[model samples]
Each structure stands twice: as structure tokens, then as C-alpha cells.
Target: MRADAQKNRDHLLAVAGTAIAEQGVEVSLRDIARRADVGLATLLRHFPTREALLDALLRTSFDELTARAGELETSSAPDEALVSWLRDCVVWTTEYRGVTVLMAAAIEDPDSALHASCVTLRSAGARLLARAQAAGTARGDIDGSDVFALVAMLAWLGDQPSLAPRAERLFGVVASALLTSAGGS
Candidate 1:
């Protein structure tokens, strides 16, 4: 990409990120372009699709979360690592309103632009869950998919205006339920 094009793309992504954070993943492409001081055609030229723009914006965060899971696995206790990573994932998901829905769909759709990043993130969570289970800290019945689902559920709570206040308490409840002992807090 040329310097000017790359600059435009970066500016568009920055505008899109703010828009999504304020509105949601479903925020209008035209609004994003307007916010970026560009024409709709320019935004479309850079992103091609909403999913593509989201992939570009969110892929870095996804990679960081996956890497965080690995770091937690080695540096923290099994139960602590699992709960900490779970909290981080849920918080990140909540940053972009309605992103949990996209992540859930992306995880199941191989052709989705976000699929690979979602898979890697889910796998990282699964590894932490497995590690905790092996250490007899987390429940053995739940697998990585269950952990992923829990993240979506938690993020959904944060999305709801009525339920937003209860999200933190619910997160603690869910974490407690997942852990065999009282260590999830």
C-alpha cells in the first residue's frame, strides 16, 4: 500500500474502533467514513466489508489476549491463570459493543475473516481451562468451548443496560462456579 493509502486505512480503522466502542459492531460504515473525514467509497476501498474492518481492528487485541493466556499459564497458578484470562477476555469483548456475538459466530465459521483469530483465542482459553482442571482447581466437566461460551455470556451481560451493573457480581459468581475451590476470586 502507498503511504497515503496506508494512512487513510489507519485513520479509518481508528475511527471505526471508536465508533464500534461507542455504538457497536453494527455501527454504520458511512458513519465511520464520515468520522474519518473520508468518503464512503474510500472506507469501502480499504475495508471491503464490515467484517474485514473489524478483523483488522480486533486481530491485534485477539493476539494479545491469546498471548496473555500463555503468559498466565506459565507465571500464575492454574486456577488464577484461568480466572484472570477469563476476566480479560470478557472485558476485551465488552470494549466493542456486540463483539461477543461476532466472536461466537466467527469461532464457528471457518470462512469468516475473524475465524482464525477467534480460534486461536478460544484454544488459548481451552489450554488454560485444561491446565486448571488438571490441577483440580477448575471443574472437569467443562471444556474450552464451555469457557468460550461463558465469556460470551458474561460479555452479553455487560452489553445490556439493565444488567450492566450486575455484570461484575455475575462474573464473580460464574468464576466461582467454574472453580472447584474458593480460589476463583
Candidate 2:
């Protein structure tokens, strides 16, 4: 891509990110174009679709979270790593309102633009969960898919106005329940 095109793309992504964070993943594409001071045709030429735009915006963060899970696997205790990754995912999901729904759907639909990133992210969390389970630190009954579902649930809780205040406390409770040691040996 030319320097100017890249610059325009970056600006669009930045504007889209802010719009999604403020309004949600479903925020108007026309609004994003207006915010970026670009024509709607320009935005569409760059992104093509809402999913494409979201994938472009979120892919970097997803990659980082996946890499972070890998680092935590080697650097932290199994249970600690799992809980930390879980917390990070929930926090990230909450930042983009209504993203959990998309993530959940994307995970189930291989054809979705977000599918690959969501799968990789979920797999990263699963590895941490598996490591904890192997060390007898986490419950063995739940698998990676369950962990993914829990992340969606936790993020959803964070999105709820009535439950937002209790999200941190509830996260602690959920994290504890995931770890066997938290319940006393």
C-alpha cells in the first residue's frame, strides 16, 4: 500500500476503534467515516464490511493477548497464568461493547471473518486452563470451550449497567471457583 493509503487506513481504524468503544461493535459505519473525515466510499473501499473493519481493528490486540498467554505459561504458575489470562480477556472484551456476542458467534462459525482470531485466542486460554488442570490447580471438569464461554459470560456481566459494579467481585468469585486450591484442599 502507498504511504497515503496506509495513513488513511490507520486513521479509519483509529476512528472506528473509538466509535466501537464508545457505542459498540454495531456502531454506524457512516459515523465512523464522518469521524475519520473520509467519504463512506473510501471507508468501504478500505474495509468492505463491518466484520472486515472489526477484524482489522481487533486482530492486533487478539494477537497480543495470545502471545501474553504463551509468556504467562512459562513465567507464571499454572493457576495464576490461567486466571490472569482470563481476567485480561474479560477486560478487553468489555472495552468494546457487545463484542462478546460477536466473539461467541465467530467461534462457532468458521466462515466468519473473526473466526480465526477468536479460535486462536480461545486456544491460548485453553492451554493455560489445561496447564492448571494438569497441575491440579484448576477444575478438571471444564475444558477450553468452557473457559471461552466463561469469558463471554464474564464480559457480558461487565457490560451490564446493573452488574458492572459487582463485576470485579464476581470475577474473583469465578476465578476462585475455577481453581481447586481456592476452595481449600
Candidate 3:
């Protein structure tokens, strides 16, 4: 693509990501094109289909989350790193319910790029889980997939404002349940 075309495509992806996260993965291509101040043809040129656009959006999110997780690895405290990951997960779930759901769904589809992204995240999450488990700050039996499932449920719960307190407590509860210690947990 040309420079301007690439710029427009980038803008469309940004708008589409925000739209999908806020509205749904089911959002129309025209809707994203309109939001991006681009024509439908341009949107189509960038993302040939809903599935393709979704794959791109999920990949972008995975990039961000993975980068965040990578940064956490530099932290000296494994427990703190786990907590940070949990917090990041909660934020993603709460703010982007549709995208979060999309992410979960993507993991189920073998051919999806989103599935590839999930694999990367799952691997990183497993490493973090191992660190915490080794430190006795979390359960040794916990699998990364379980963490994924819990976060998916939390994301679904994120839309309920009345459940704000419970929403906030969800991560802590899960963390406590995973911990080997009694008092601190």
C-alpha cells in the first residue's frame, strides 16, 4: 500500500479495535469505516472480511497484553507480577467485553490468528503461574487455561455496574484461592 493508504489503514484498525471492544466483534465493516473517516472500499482493502479484521484486532490486543506481561517479568517480585497480570486482565475484561469474548472464542478456533496470540499469552501466563507456585504464593496445581477461563468469566461479569464490588473482589478471591498461605492470602 502507498504511504497515505497505509496511514488510512492504520487509522481504520485503530477505530475498529475501539469499536469492537466497545460494541462487539459483530460490528459491521461499514461502521468501522465510518468511524475511521474512510470509505468502505478503503476498509475492505485493509480488512477483507469481518474475520480478518477481528483477527487483526485480537492480534493487536495480544501484542499489547503480551508486552505488558513481558514488562512484568522484569519485576523482582513474582507475586507482584502475578497481581499485575490479574489487574491487566481485569481491565481488559471490563473495558472491552466484546473483544475479550472474541479473544476467548479465538482460542477455540485452530486456524485463527487470535488462537496463535492466545498460545503466546498462555505460555507467558504459565511461566508466571509457575513462578508464583514455586514461591508458594499461589497453588502449584493451577494451570494457565484455568486462569484464562476465570478471566473470561470475569470479563462477562464486567458489564454489571451493580456488581462493581464483586467485580473488584473477583481477582482477589481467585488469587486467595490459589495461594498456599493462610493469613496473607
Candidate 4:
């Protein structure tokens, strides 16, 4: 890409990130172009599709989240690290109003542009869950899929207008239930 073209793409990505963060993923591409002071054709040339744009916009954050999980695995206790990362995942997935739904769908669809990032995100949490289970802090029977489902469920709950306020507390309860000690004899 030429210097001007690269500048336009960078500006578009930054503007789109702010717009989507403020207005949700449903914000119009035309509006993004307008906000970035770029023509619609320029935006299209940079990102051929909405998913492509989204994939570009979210890829960095997803990578950061995955990296954070690895850092937490080394820096925190197994269960604490898992729970902390899970909480962070909830926040990441629900940052934009409609993003949780997008992530949930993308995680299951290999054809989606966001699929690889979503898989990486899930794998990060799975690694933490595996560590916790191995340490006997989390339930032995629960696997990475279970942890992924819990994160997805929490993200879904957060997307609900009525349930959004209760999401954190609900997450706490669910996280507690996933602990080995929570299942008292």
C-alpha cells in the first residue's frame, strides 16, 4: 500500500473503532466513511465487507486478550487467573452493543473472518481452565468447552438490556459454581 492509502486505512480503523465502541456494531459504513473523512469507495477498497472491517477492528483486542491470559497464567494463581480472565472476556465480548452476538456466531463459523480470532480467544480461556482444573481448584469434570460456554452465556446475558446490570453478579455466581469447593460433600 502507498503512504496515502496506508494513512487512510489507519485513520479508518481508528475512527471505526471509536464509532463502533460508542454506537455499537450496527453503525453504518457510510457513517464511518463520513466520520473518517474518507470516501465510501476508499473505505470499501480498504475493507471489502462489514465482517472484514470488523475482523480488522477487533483483531488487536482479541490478540491482547489472549496475551493477557498467558500473562495471567504465569502471574496469578490458577483459579484466580481463570476467573479474572473470564471477567475480562465478558467485558471484551460486550464492549460494543451487538458484538457479543457477532462473537458467538463467529466462533462457530469457520467461514467467518472473525473465526480465527474467536478461536484464539476461547483457547486462551481454555488454557486457564485447564490449569485451574489440574490444580484442583476448579471442577475436574468441566472442560475448556464448558468454560467457553460459560463465557459465551455471560456475554449473552450482558447483551440483554434488562439483564445487563446483573451480569457481573451472575458471573460471580456461575464462577463460584464452577469451583471444586462449591460442590460440598
Question: For this target, which candidate reaches the highest lDDT against the unseen true structure?
Answer: 1
True-structure RMSD for candidate 2: 1.5
lDDT of 4 by residue, 1-185 (tens): 89988888999999998899888898999999999998999899999999999999999999999999999999998889898888888888777667877888899999999999989988998898888888888888887777878877898898888998999899989888877883221
Full-model lDDT for every candidate = 0.94, 0.93, 0.75, 0.88
Worst 10 residues of 2 by lDDT: 176-185
Question: TM-score of each candidate?
Answer: 0.97, 0.97, 0.87, 0.90
lDDT per residue (tens digit) for residues 47-165 in model 1? 89999999999999999999999999999999999999999999999999999999999999999999999999999999999999898899999999999999999999999999999
Clashing pairs in 1: none
lDDT of 3 by residue, 1-185 (tens): 78987787778878987887777777788888989887898788888888787777667766787788888878746777776786787687676546666667778888876788887877777777787777777777778888777777777767666776687677678767766672133
Clashing pairs in 3: none
Candidate 4 Cα misplacement greater than 4 A, ranges: 182-185
Candidate 2: where is the Cα deviation over 4 Å? 182-185
Model 1: CA > 4 A from native: none
Per-residue CA lDDT of candidate 2, range 1-185, in tens?
99999999999999999999999999999999999999999999999999999999999999999999999999998998999999999999999999999999999999999999999998999899999989889998998999999999999999999999999999999999999964321
Scored against the true structure, residue 17 in model 4 reaches a CA lDDT of 89
